[model samples]
Target: MIPVLWHLGNVVVDLVLDVPALPERGGDVLATRTEHTPGGGFNVMAAAARQGLAVTYAGAHGTGPFGDRARAALHTEGIGILLAPRTSGDTGFVVCLVDADGERTFVTSPGAEASLTPADLAELRPGAGDLVYITGYGLLHDSNRAALLGLLPRLDPAVTLVTDPGPLAGDIPTEALETLLTRSDWWSCNAREAALLTGLDDPAEAARALQSRLGRGAVLVRTGPDGCLLHHGGRLVAVPGFAVDAVDLNGAGDAHTGVFMAALARGADPVAAAHRANAGAALAVTASGPATAPDAAQLDAFLN
Candidate 1:
């Protein structure tokens, strides 16, 4: 069977520390809780696998302690990993500190996650009717970016590309971003990312601008709490989000996109898929880390 889901991107473990207040330089603060789990592309693949898809995670990991732990973590999540060994360097990591309001500040270290090459993409080639999810971060790096772009045009028309341009800081070239978006069937982004992409403040406006740029189908703009808006199918529709007690916001968006793609792979309608995605994301933030994402049955139960 063809893989219903394919993720070619960075895989890292995130360590979260929640503090009452974000501390300043030279200030001492105690964290409320410290939680660590697999994050990024690995997290997305794990979430999708739990939703009962045939998922493959193709990326890079180091031979160091963090990489070993990260691979083990992916195994526990039931994600199939196509890992490239890193001869030297630690695996990727994020040190996130969430404040009382649930906002987080991150200090990211891209270690092994940054080492993926075009050679890695060759291992997980797609057949007809497969879906590939590409992260913007992976495409920012030179070696991997060329590899990623090379795979795009060759994608079977039966295949659909879902992209999350996560944090398009100066790393990702503008032309690469445009090319990726131009090739993708569905584009998912949060409010800030939407704004950065379209230069629009309102989420709805951002969706409109993005749709205009792409001009083929819908643009999914994820608004925190207010819900996600889709500008496509000749209309602007909103998928209402559940109000959940958010512990840590890390991986919530990725969880939403993962399950959303799973639903699409199952041939669900766009609106219905969005609802399913919304429920999945709600379940994701209830826990402190990525591994706690709900499975298909659990997400359905939550919906019921």
Candidate 2:
């Protein structure tokens, strides 16, 4: 199988607090419960690692409790860490407030992960058949934006570049976003991000617009429980999502992207890969934390 090199510097510890509802301004509400877990980039990389993919995380870890926990979680999942802790700052963390309906709002404190340098990118030597994954969050921070942009031209032409602009898709600089669209082999994002990027309300139209921009690439528009729409090889296909009782919607998209990339690396066709991704995402939502993606056996059982 081809290696999946995940450029995931956004790993963080998530402190999830369950609340009855969002508190109004100046009002305080007590949380019903709290759970701490590994989140952010770990959600994506762990999802692929659990599927038995040769996954490597090319990112920085910081010192402190958050970084310690993050390292331990990666070790537990059998994922490789190619980068060492270089930053003096502590690892980042987020306070996730989940409401009764499972909707979550996050307040984040970014740290060392937001300071990726160009030297870090130069160290990554991806070759043909390797898939490189990046997210929009990496582009949002000013400290890392130039580094990420510089890394793009240095990437091997034979390497497949996959990107998910995430919810901050609209906030990315126009030039950077254009470069990514032109260079990306596979572009994946949720419906809201699609609309923001292409200004198209219909997902199919959004997918088409994005595909056209890619010239020789494909586009995937993930539409929550309704599943995803794919535009590839001049054809538009709708991949239906699996029906499952969703307990936590967080990280579902990350799970889908991870599994989709893993399946493709293992020689599955686009539609077949999408099916497995759907199953993996369904299973992810049935669990609580952001890093709750299923392993190969669990994914197979769910599909069966």
Candidate 3:
């Protein structure tokens, strides 16, 4: 059975410019490349589909060029998209500049992304055996957050919920995080997100804290370069990421989350599935864009 991934969150276009160094005010920088790719919710959906998962993405986008680009991009990856109506405001966009070390700084205009409201939840209806991946920002905002909270009771018991508290997941109130975690089978976060969420300086402790807060849900803390720690019931499992000369770290974590969810949907054990996700994510950074995620064959070869 093919894994069906339901992604709900903001959709934007990443306009990335490779500069020799960070740009200065009133100064011009030469960009090695300028490219736009589907970001946020769509990025996760596209990555999952590339790894052979069947994906459906429901999100808001303006009727501008950015929205058109997002739709075209998702369709190219075989992702089913349910686009929200266009608004008079500008489409969502993130202007990012990457330095020599592959570190990125972003300037964002939420625009249509911020317009995604509770009413938009009507688009999601997951079946048994499907994996629901909720992006963090959707649950951070009051309106959409309530919508996501209300939908928890409707989730099929056979369906697994994988929550990616994107960059802002930790910034939300603890009560909100608790509400989302209660319905999640897996809680995935990066080192920074773990620290921010649990107020624990150490990622391992943060993982434990999150696990405790979620009661029975598994806490997966992603430590870039060092690997990931999966915490459950006072026990921890370490899944190290594959070593690769990473060019761009954009969407690597999302790739990991998508692949791990896909593996879980395929009935793989958590540890093994995490290892596979590591491989897929490791392959992700070798390229520069959100769609850089590898297919099953590429991941299998990398694993071999």
Name the candidate that leads on lDDT. 2
> Which regions of candidate 1 deviate over 4 angstroms?
169-171, 215-217
Which candidate comes out best when scored by TM-score? 2
Clashes within 3 Å, all models in order:
0, 0, 0
lDDT by candidate, in order shown: 0.81, 0.85, 0.80
Q: In model 2, which residue pairs have backbone atoms overlapping below 3 Å? A: none
For candidate 3, give the lDDT. 0.80
List ranges where model 3 is wrong by over 4 Å. 24-29, 87-90
Q: Rank the models by TM-score, top first.
A: 2, 1, 3
Better of 2 and 3 by TM-score: 2
Which parts of model 2 have CA positions greater than 4 angstroms off?
Answer: none
RMSD for all candidates, in order, please: 1.8, 1.4, 2.1
Give candidate 1's error at residue 25 in angstroms. Answer: 4.3
Q: Per-residue lDDT for 1-304 in model 3, tens only?
A: 5658877777788888888898689889899989887787776776678777888876667888888888888888898876655667656888878878877777777766666665677646788889887777776667767777777778887788888887776567677777787878899989988888878979888888888878447989999866789996569988887789999888788888888887887788888888988888888888987657788888889899
- Give residue 285's error in model 2 in angstroms: 0.8
